[model samples]
Target: MFDIARQHLKTPRDLLRFAMSRFTEAGLFFGHGTDNAWDEAAYLIAHTLHLPIDRFDALLDARLLPSELNDALDILERRVSERVPAAYLTREAWLAGHDFYIDERVIVPRSFIAELLPDGLSPWIEHPELVHRALDLCTGSGCLAILLADAYPDAEVDAVDLSTDALDVATLNIERYGLEQRVTPIESDLWAGVAGNRYDLIVSNPPYVDAESVAALPDEYLKEPELALGSGEDGLDATRAILEQATHFLNPFGVLVVEIGHNRDVLEALYPALTFTWLDTSGGDGFVFLLTREDLVTGGL
Candidate 1:
């Protein structure tokens, strides 16, 4: 297949078709930024050829230089043989039209909470300027922290993570966005590092993949750090801690939002007294939930 591609693949379109065929044949799992062979192939081809990913269709038939073809082929080969996600291969991931550096050091940033951040958590958050401080728990790569800084320009965001390696990557990304002053990366387990710090808003995309799901994850998912994916046997350890401790850190009238993957039912079943308001995202309402400080205090969960 390599020999045939080298001899016959001449244009971006050819590479696209070849990548699609190869990826399909390899049964590659896609979820980081794209979900299918065609999208993944186009992303890789565009990234390799130095073309805008969104402009891939415009250059499909354009001829590729020999060097360009070689680079594309190399990336495609790695995609199949290595089972690495395209985002990791390209060293970048996109969320809500924003791009951040990504690698094995941190899980690929795909938080549905990103969709709500751009709107400043509107309606719930009456005014963006009113938010003076925000917290991002389990903030791998500092993507959500950066977004929080952007959403509430006046707010100071503290991104907390347990892994030093993930904090290093988060620091790199924090510096990349020139947010050195507004976003601070903290190394601590959950809320321990930010004791006595009150915030107007708290958002988290913590480890929620259940034991069974983690055990059966695809090779691409296994490439990420297990500490960033698995929670507990039932996958609510992090969420449980967050809900229990958030009331202490939240200011009066503050809001708490969290993404729990597919554990909405399980979480609700566990905390039957709590009233969870699910937020709608591109995926659906079940993936993220919103609560107020009053709700947390009242539920006492």
Candidate 2:
């Protein structure tokens, strides 16, 4: 198949079409960064050609050089055979219009919390400049921590993770964004490393995939670190820990925003007394929830 591609797939359009067909035929999963074969193919192809990924229309008919063609086919073949997320192949993930370096060390950055950052957690945060401290638990590649630094310029954002390898990637991204002084990468089990630190805002996109779902995850998802995906049985272990201990880590009027995946019902059922203000994202409101320090202390989770 690759030989045939090499012989016939000369242009970006030919490669794009061939890739989409191959990806679809392979029954590949598309949850990481892209959700369709077209976008995935375009991204891998664009990256292969060293062209702009988002502006592929101009490059479609342009023929790739011999070397670029080989690289494009190689990456496409890997995407089919390896079943790893494309971000793992390309070592890049974009969230909220910002690119972050990513690898198998961390799950691809697809946090609904990312959608909230641009508005600076408006109304709830009230003033982004007033935010002096922020925390991103399960920081993964420190994507959110970098975003937090961008969102709240005055805030010192701490990016915490259990995996040193993940923290290492986060540190690279922090340096990439030139946020080294503002975003501190800490290796800890959630809030363990930052116990004494209080924050005006805390954001997390923790491991929330349930046991059943994790077992049935696609090969692409399986390629990611399991520790970054599954929590306890109901997928609420990390979320529960965050809720129970968040109030102590937050300032008197601080707010907590979390992306719980599909566990809103499970989380709400577990803590019925807590009034979770579901935040709206492109995926919908149920995936993320917000709570104030008052709500946490009052609900007594």
Candidate 3:
């Protein structure tokens, strides 16, 4: 019993480490994402100590109380047994290298846009300097909205989302990133709230997952809000809405960079008569496309 207790309390640099010896007994126990079972355990333990994961190493030198250990295991057990996202359990997520508060109030942070933000998306934007006005549509967690503000320090950004719940999360992210002034968190349904407003860039990681795809996603995805994941069966309803309204809201030199994920082929097929540039990356091809206002008006897309 002493060995078991000590093992569960072991930490790399003095932080608590819970054993995974009992996780399998709790569920279908497929070990689907079990390689990081220790990570899940640490997350729960770290939270109880009011320390971030990075701080755990230094803070672990202090001893954990019995109650903290017991409470952590209880949360970790629930996570493994239920296949709930650790972010949902922790009420936070890290995106674009920043930590943001989150909850069931919003979807977990996941976006191809994050890949493009860090390096200025050199290949996609010819004149990144000209990106003065930008918009982050369906800004669920406001992750993209905040990232853009940080990337374009000189530019003011707008974050629009239909859900007040999501906007609330976005609000926290905006405030956390100190982008409250630069990034406006608006509760608007797509273009409705920004009527007649034109931007140099409109970026969106919208709800493009079709019903079938959403249903097929990993159990971790089951924890997110359905509104943030699903589009119509074809998955183009939201895309079409954005594309149709985007051109009217873009400057002559502006471009709409949107992420379609695996539905790129479907989009390409639907627009068989037109053309789009799909971005290639080390991981895989993204469904991101840069559409210009002139191209939309000229049917040159």
TM for every model, in the order presented, reads 0.98, 0.98, 0.83
How do the residues 43-107 of candidate 1 rate in per-residue lDDT, one tens digit apiece? Answer: 88898889997777888999888889999999999999999988899998988777899889999
The candidate maximizing lDDT is 1
Q: 1-301 in candidate 3: lDDT tens per residue?
A: 3235545664433333333445434432222212355565566667756777777666666666776665665666667667777777777777667778878878878776777773646644555576788999999989888888777777799999999999988888888778877999888989999998999878998998898887787777767788988899978789989877777899888778888867887887877655565665433675677667776767634
Clashes of each: 0, 0, 1
Clashing pairs in 3: 14-60
Q: Per-residue error at 73 for model 3, in Å?
A: 1.1
Candidate 2 residue lDDT tens string, 1-301: 9888898878999998999899989999998988899999999989878898667898799867889899999999999998989999999899988999998989898988887884836788887887999999999999889988998889899999999999999999999989888999998998889988899999999999999999999899889899999998999999999999998899999999999998888888999999999988889889999999999988985
When 1 and 3 are scored with TM-score, the better candidate is 1
lDDT of each prediction vs. the true structure? 0.92, 0.90, 0.74
- The C-alpha RMSD in Å for every predicted model, in order, reads 1.0, 1.0, 3.9
Which residue pairs in model 1 clash with each other? none
